[model samples]
Target: MKTLLRLSFAAIFAALVGCATPQVPVPLDQSFYTADKKTVGLMLEAPKAPGLALEGNIGLLDYAIIAAATSSLTDHIEGQDLGEFLAVAEELSQNLENEGFELVRLQVPEKAPKLAKFKDPDGKDTTYFAAKDHRTLADQYQVDYLLKLTATRAGLARPYYGFIPTDAPRAVFNVHGEMIDMSSNQLLWYSDIAHSAYATGEWDEGPSFPGLTNTYYVVMNKAKQDVLGALAKRESATGTLALNDDEEAEATESSETPAESQQ
Candidate 1:
């Protein structure tokens, strides 16, 4: 009887181990190019604006604000909330500056009033006030172009039991951005980029968190680069044609027509 019991326990352990799955690795796909290849004004959206919604959440700014407020004082993630949208905007602005592009700073007002309360996991109400101040800042800065970006998770799977704490079959992120011509109130450019990464284990508070994964940055940078690149490409193409036209005109003048030569 004792031997049989031991055998059963061993079999169960083996089965659980066999069922474990390996974590999936994330991928990065990034590119930048211009369509017109011309120099144009580039302005970054205000970080304070409640933009870039994720999973029905208020937006990146709201998330950052919440994260900063809730984080332990000693934690690195703590402090004033800049939100994801603003963080990305700042990064892109720096990148554009480094590349020698003309950058315009715009201050667009927030469309929605700051929320007075938020739903916590424990069904408690959490009050927020910083958002109100940020909204005011957005209104003060009148920007020429508004760049709106949104991030959403399409799917999440349960974790496997054995080797790893979690194993998602697939994780998808939909990233999209729109360039709004504030003057015309029209969308001048819009594009969406989707990418998938495998989650090997349950996400923990660390560098490996899905949010920290470079995949998000890859998609965002590509989107930004795409806008600037198109403008740059257009300019390059136009300049080349202009130069060629000038050369041809000079050649024609040098080879005077017979009637003009006779004179």
Candidate 2:
């Protein structure tokens, strides 16, 4: 059991793209963060896709190999929500407030209410907002700026198993978020966010398999922390957000602190 756990740990860590893959402030418009913008509301919207399809051909042992390594192929696992989304929101809100930007918690509608996701005139997925209804929401909330976590794609499975270089277990995902001007309905910022936690060939956090929901839980938490760091402009550099400083305080302090639950 101990040896198996160690092997599994090695397998997971092997797949991690540690301390990289995210660029902060996400290269937003210069005007997004101005001198007088007071309040900002958060819209948490993202597609949760789990179990990227395995791509390749394999013989009999393939079945057992895949079975042992992956949790599910294409079952829409939604993976799991270890409360990372809410944590991200909470962190952002607090960060903005500390920076003198008022924070407003917007309610995620029960139904699809009025989504702001669509192709724009520029032939790009430039801005996706719910047109009139979203504007109404903005008006109702009285927020000056709206930040939307456009998409957070996370899961624990080898998406391009055959195409990738190595066979190791790592928590991986492609996540991005943006800021928007509700009045003009424009994209203010954007970035491709990624995070990872390489298992250390030991039961550091807990036992490990080839991959599991728990693996992503650990990974997403790290990702959520950086999302706040980037938006707060604290992690403006192109390296991992430094840990041994005051900038890391919130990421450390509030990680266990859950945001108000959402639907």
Candidate 3:
């Protein structure tokens, strides 16, 4: 009976993951940056997925589980980055900044205690990390734009064939992420994907390893790249950026021919 149940779920899961379409970046709209604004706040949230589980996980004893339990046992563990996520907004600003907003840097004292809260109690876009006094945050740093980035929600699943693991079976990885424009309190872009063949590069067959498996890093990177690509600035004609007043004066003096003074 127990074996039947595991097989049943695995079959259903496999069917779902196998037929799913590959996901891509959302349609980007640079039009949202139409306002005269500068100074952007970075909000990179942590990823989370509460329900996904790994089957047959007992560390050194994984293969030793009783026949039934071996196929039924499951475990789950979360992944986190040291500080790699902090620079996303800043990196994205190389061209976007010139569009209008400059990302605000947070020093030790200036950093917020919680700058990555995901959602509210109701699973809605509460954005608790965005400081209650939005106006104050904006005024303090003169930040007119706040780019709130929800962490990529990563989930993992290992599908089985008839309660047995196949040769190098792929793992399913799904992520849903978005960018919010706090100035208008609306979504600027969004992308969500669930894939194994495409997300983990299991489709291509040129290079094959003896036992290469997908890890959190692989899945998370795919999701992260999607966001970066979606937000990437499109190449376009642009004028020379205006320099600050001091630099402008220095440039003016340097460009002048030393007053063509009598020598």
Candidate 4:
């Protein structure tokens, strides 16, 4: 009878142990870019989606189940929420335009609603969200290039423990953009940009989940600058400037000055 009771208690304990397991969030893919060399029309695709989950527990395991759980703990593990992505996209578009790229804003299908409601981190009420569908928004904007972006993991870091101190929370982002020839549907150029930053604790309070998302917009903006820099460098190397014919004519004259002088 005692053995039977012990077995039942063990089963209950095992169930509780399973419930106590920690589940770390899955990370998202970084953003990248692609384009056709001839037309220089760019197409950007966001990295694969990221999900919110507990930190450091990538493989969730309960403390009771393991004889000795790893001494390390993660500060905060969470995915980049939708609000963050929208802000990033806006910044990225502006950055591309500033860099002399004609970006077309892709719209979701007309039949579908422009904005959809989603749950925020607080889990209070539904909030509006948007996506880049390409078909609907393309007509409204006159663009030779299209840019798309996805938000991967925003904040990630190891947790602080007596045995192992936690590292700074780093922000990871993946962004891809491509330039395609509108007529030929050929790829001209593309770039895959990824970035990571250590958590300074300034964005959030004590590694809590609330403010982790705030850093996403800032990181994405930085990423835009990075992508722009890359494109600018590529443009400089290829001599396929984004300037109009008038500008090209002037550039040609400028290049002839030394030759004319030598002659």
Q: Model 1 segments beyond 4 Å from truth? A: 1-87, 98-140, 154-167, 199-263
TM-score of 1: 0.33
lDDT of 2: 0.54
Predicted candidate 4 versus true structure: per-residue lDDT over 156-203, tens digit per residue: 333333323255444555565554333322233444556655444554
Candidate 3 wrong stretches, greater than 4 Å: 1-26, 47-52, 55-90, 93-95, 98-100, 105-142, 160-175, 193-195, 198-218, 235-263
Q: Write one digit per residue (lDDT tens) for candidate 1, span 1-263.
A: 23223333554665688775422221111112232222223333432211111122133234344334323321322122324434555555655454444445443335654534322234243211111122232333344444555542222222323222233233333445555443333345555545444444553435334432333333333343333332232234354221236545854764483211000
Cα displacement (angstroms), candidate 2, residue 176, comes to: 2.3
Report every candidate's CA lDDT: 0.36, 0.54, 0.44, 0.39
Query: For residue 100, what is the lDDT in candidate 1?
Result: 48
Candidate 2, run of 10 with poorest lDDT: 202-211
The candidate 3 region of ten consecutive residues with least summed lDDT is 203-212
Model 4: residue 216 alpha-carbon error in angstroms = 4.7
**True-vs-predicted CA distance for residue 170, candidate 2, Å:** 2.9
* Best of the two (1, 2) by lDDT: 2
Instruction: List the candidates' TM-scores in order.
Output: 0.33, 0.55, 0.44, 0.39
Number of the top candidate by lDDT?
2
> In angstroms, how far off is 79's CA in candidate 2?
8.8
Off by over 4 Å in 2: 1-26, 45-81, 111-136, 159-169, 196-198, 202-218, 234-245, 248-263
